[model samples]
Target: MDHDQINNQSRGAEGKDTKADGAAVAPQFSRDAVFPGEVVGEVTDLNRQDLEKQKAAQGSAHFHRLGWKRLTVVLIVEAIALGSLSLPAAFATLGMVPGVILCISLGLIAIYTSDVVGQVKLKFPHVSHYADAGQLMMGRFGYELVGAMFALQLTFLVSSHTLTGAIAFGNITNNGACSIVFAVVSAIILLILAIPPSFAEVAILGYIDFVSIILAIGITMIATGINKDSITTAPWSAWPQDGLTFAEAFIAITNIVFAYSFAICQFSFMDEMHTPSDYKKSIWALGLIEIFIYTLTGALIYAFVGQEVQSPALLSAGHTISKVAFGVGLPVIFISGSINTTVVGRYIHGRMYKDSIIRFINTKMGWITWLTLITVITVLAFIIAEAIPFFSELLSISSSLFISGFTFYFPAMMWFMLIREGSPFATHNLWKTALNGLCFVIGMIVLVCGTYASIVEIAHKFKTGAISSPFTCAALA
Candidate 1:
């Protein structure tokens, strides 16, 4: 599964630039793997064979190319996309005290688990994706298991964005167009924007997505803050009202977790860094930013709007603010969806083509193949988005089924397995072992209980007709 074995259709112009000759060259493969299962290209300092060193010498611009700033923006956008929107509603459901506590606590836990991923990569520099980490611990089965889980997680994420993007469109248009039309429109946009061959190529556009969300939320905050007098809000009730249940609250908790469920991405990000040491800086920077944003945004919005605050919290605004905010947020929903789609696409492209990705990137047929995958993925996401339009329910189910594994379970396994591998003869460190065990148990609880809660909630929504049916003209707005 090396470059030579793949269809090197454009093999003649091996080392030349496609633009210089106006012909796609055979990719001069790079030794710098951006994590094996994830998107790749950059050069690495690590030693390999002489052949690889030659390949590294000739790699294109896309490989191992990200610096700390670009990496930070990418990570922040991924975390902030769909998950950050629900924090206000989470606060409303769990009360300000518990909600803030969860926001800080979970954000910290997410950082710790992210650090665990970094450590795992440090130990096994070749590890590329979640499956690569899994394979290190349990061979082929582990690789497939973890790989499929993450692929599914990314797919679920893309679908969630599709649903949310359509909602955002509806929210902006006052439900003028059918949501299904918006979904298709959003899907087309994602496919076109995701044409870049690697995440590194997309890094430059990260700021646009980030700005879109900031303006969107900032507008909502300003609009709501100005009209505080008219807003009706509940006193912080210690528990749910008679009709609303704790299941609803946990779903909110799951939403916050969903916001921080970024462990699955650490591998890909780390692989692209020019200096691996900068990764610690990236994680800490991300954690601090999220803590401030999540707590402040959630508390302020919830305090003003109280228990009736919508999941996105944007929707709880006055009609004008809601429309303006969602319209402003347009780039984020689409950008975030495209990023996730590319992550899924990268994993598949790497698996199918292995080390031949650079060659794939250099060919016209390769771009066609990539576009085809993107089109197919968007179609799938569209169908799912239409079928389950409830935002919180979709987030919760994704969280329960995969978030825990991505953020907690996989990291703990990496920690424990790495420790044992480094010191096979030494007695296991009791305190470290206990801590990892605790993390694993917590992850399992969230996965099992949270999944049951989300499914039950989705079922209830269906039975009560609280959500729209597939392809309906009814406003999901």
Candidate 2:
């Protein structure tokens, strides 16, 4: 069937009544009345005509074009980037055993929570973003709270990309100019790339992004492996570093947590999917891909470079090859970063013009407002990146403060408030109840301990002058 027919069927399905917990009730239309092909065609055509008229009235912008494959690609574009490279440094602190365990286990939990996110989307088709889901759970206050959290998290992600991009440029050019100049360039590029407001449009770049990161990672791994014998004779440990402190350990764990934060944007991405229920496929595809890449990247790179492995990991591959790796990985860094801006832009723009055609962002006014909003977001991200010059610390603090809720506890609360069907003590509900409880506890621990760890580490770095002053021309590596 065509897009119109599929959308018509979706509308028909959604028209049916649902329970308070979002379970489907009896269908509104009789099956016999819609059974025949000709009748179905007529109904679909009428709905299609109505929709086309609405599209023309509103503008040509369309949101529901993403399929499962493309959705998977978008999730990959958002999820795996600097975080993948950061894993080796985390592994250096946590060692192979804990690192691998956290990588795989947290990945699985993220996948499960993302599945819950998808189910909530499927059930409540009106939830266009995470903030909308928050409203469903806690009214206007929750909406504003989650809205701020969502915006801040995405902004932090953009800041991370901005920082990574500056680092990439500095490494590629061997610090050819002021780092602040590079950061400004990065922000401008992010703003330009974020101009397109559609997730489906962004997914097209995800193809190139996927290839760029893979090639960069492969090059780093090979170069590191080749130079391994010459560099370090020390064997990589299976246990945590001997002097690892509580703060250090938690920061490492939070970095790993940061890597699995794909679930944070699932609702926003799914809002544009034509088949949101197929998000299971996307999450599984993304989750497994992330787990394999993160585990392998962290384990192999740390083993090659030992405890001295750097945050981006590419920097550990020797000077010349590290430059090559950064060049290869540049697309992933910017593209992934820009998508975060697009997401936040869409959210704020949609809210600002919810009852107006400007929400579609295809009109002249829509384009102007969209560009303005994204520019503001990019500038804010640049400021944040400059303020937090340390790489691992920024990621750790952001993950601890925001991602802990977005990836873990929020979804756990979602299960209790919106997704759960029956009593938790019921035979079939017991396991899921326990699982979600664990997720909530995990989120809380990350929020509290991870934040403490990040603050402590940052204070120590400041005290010892280990961190570079903001906007300095000093080399990031």
TM-scores of the models, in the order given: 0.84, 0.87
Candidate No. with top TM-score? 2
After superposition, the stretches of candidate 2 with alpha carbons farther than 4 Å from their true spots are 1-61, 387-395
Give the alpha-carbon lDDT of every model: 0.75, 0.87
Clashing pairs in 1: 35-128, 36-128, 41-63, 42-63, 42-64
Q: How much lDDT does candidate 2 score?
A: 0.87
- Model 1 TM: 0.84
For model 1, the run of ten residues with the poorest summed lDDT: 38-47
